[model samples]
Target: MRELTFENVTVRFGSRRRGTVAVDDVSLRVPAGQVVGLVGESGSGKSTLARAAVGLAPLASGRISPAPHERHVQMVFQDPYSALDPRMSVGESIAEAGRRAVDVAGLLELVGLPGDRAGDRPHLLSGGQRQRVALARALAGDPEVIIADEITSALDVSIQGAVLNVVRELQRRMNLTMLFISHNLAVVRYVSDIVAVMKDGRIVEYGPVDEVLGDPRHEYTRELLAAVPRPAH
Candidate 1:
């Protein structure tokens, strides 16, 4: 019964007089062992909502209740270089999140990185490799929920698929409840079990991924799908 629930959540930033509303009274449910995609254009509050799930953003009102088992929820940011320590070895970074003596080799293997890479610094690895290390670090927490914010947006197209595959495999094996935030519709559709579309700090459409993406009812959702780039025959 592990799950994450957001009840009438509102997240505002800055002074009330000129404050900006990032997440506005949005309520959503993410059942355990489910990958919920939060998709929207830039400034649509997708990232804000994901950050709030992990307590990175302050809630102006409402509540976010994490499952009892979910004592630690980790986030994998878009920029691995920034998220990771430039001076620390990959193994040290992972161990830091574990808050205990973690098996760095095993974690590297799990993320498809070679064991020897554990001693390398963040700047030495390729963009894709660094991202994998970031994933391993997030996994080190043994989190009940993982918030991935635009993780693939920084990688090359060819590398994006590989990174995504690792995430999908880990989610299935770990039975992780994931809040995947991205502006790419295709990527969201590929990884999400359920989809929540946000626009201007509100969920404009939500449902099973197939239902929402396949037969979108909301005008904004329809427009989003239509805007996705398609290859010509």
Candidate 2:
């Protein structure tokens, strides 16, 4: 188990004077073998942070330990349809990211996908299945840290739980360190050991999952909690 850390991380787009700061001096940690959920509304820099971790976004300042070149990190993107290649079979895609002689079937099974589905192309799978395939590919690389960036947002509500279950189960079974990013407080509460609330480009509140959710200190967090759908008796 490897702990992932961000030290005063920042990200910007376009020119320095004219560019917008997507993430601002954000420092958070995902402890080894634990899940840290990053929750915020859209345009809150949640996705940008994830992208920076995976080296997809250029960092203007600060550092992310276990850099992408070290191959200790892998990211599962939000859009399942676009995450995988249209031309490659799911198995091939997994193999492409994996070290030599990867067990494509086993990785599929790890994500609750059948071994036989390996031959299916991205178009042949349902949205949930494609997301599962993406998860499998991430695992094939044997990453120490996994960044799940709003992975369930694009899926049907009925299937979101299924995907989340796979994620939580895998994290526990593998003792994986993960950063689970989402806008849904309920979803974050369901899977996180710790929670960080972001508004604008900075984290406004962060603490243990139950503490932060049950007794939020930040006004933004309270508003987000209020927006959550309460169960009907």
Candidate 3:
């Protein structure tokens, strides 16, 4: 397991004068073997931070350090369909992560899919199954840290719960360090050990899931919590 660290990170888009600041002076630490949830509304810069962690976005300043054994951090994106190749078999897609030594069957089983499903293509599977395959592919490289960016947003509630369960179990059993990015506070509370609430490109509140979500000090955090739909008992 490896820890991911972001020290005084900043990311800007376009020109310095005409550009937008996606992430502003952000400092975060995702310790090894723990899940850190980054939550915010659209354009709040949580996704940019996740992208920076995975080396997908250029940081205007600061540093991102991946775990020692990981060649690179892997990301499980929001749209598995777009992330995966339609022509490739699920097994082949997983093997693309360059872990040929890990058998396809093992990879499938690791993500809660049957071993025999490896030969199936992305189009042949349900959205949840495709996302699981995406997870398997992300795991193929044995990454020290996995960045999951709004992975459950596209799935139905039932499927989302199942997927979250798979992810939670995997994190525990594999001791995988993870950064789970989402706009939903409820989902973040369900899966995260620590939660960071973002607003206007900066973290407004961060702490243990219960403490931050239960007793939000920031006004933005309070508004976010109040926005979540609650079930009537």
TM-score of each: 0.96, 0.98, 0.96
> Which one wins on lDDT?
2
lDDT of each: 0.90, 0.95, 0.90
Could you give the candidate ranking by lDDT, starting with the highest?
A: 2, 1, 3
| Candidate 3: tens digits of C-alpha lDDT, residues 125-218 | 9999999999999899878889999999999888999999999999999999999999998889889999998899998888999999888899
Report the C-alpha lDDT of model 1 over 1-233, residue by residue, as the tens digit. 26778899999999888999999999998889999999999999988888888777889998888822355678899986688889899989999989677899999999999988988988899999999999999988878888899999989999999999999999998899888999999999999999999999999898999999999999999999999999999
Cα shift from native, residue 191, model 2 (Å): 0.7
Clashing residue pairs for model 2: none
What's model 3's lDDT at 134? 90
> What is candidate 1's local distance difference test score?
0.90
Q: For residues 136-165, could you state the per-residue lDDT of candidate 2 as single tens digits?
A: 999989899999999999999999999999
Which TM-score value belongs to model 3? Answer: 0.96
> Model 1: runs farther than 4 Å from truth?
67-71
Selected candidate, larger lDDT, 1 vs 2: 2
Better of 2 and 3 by TM-score: 2
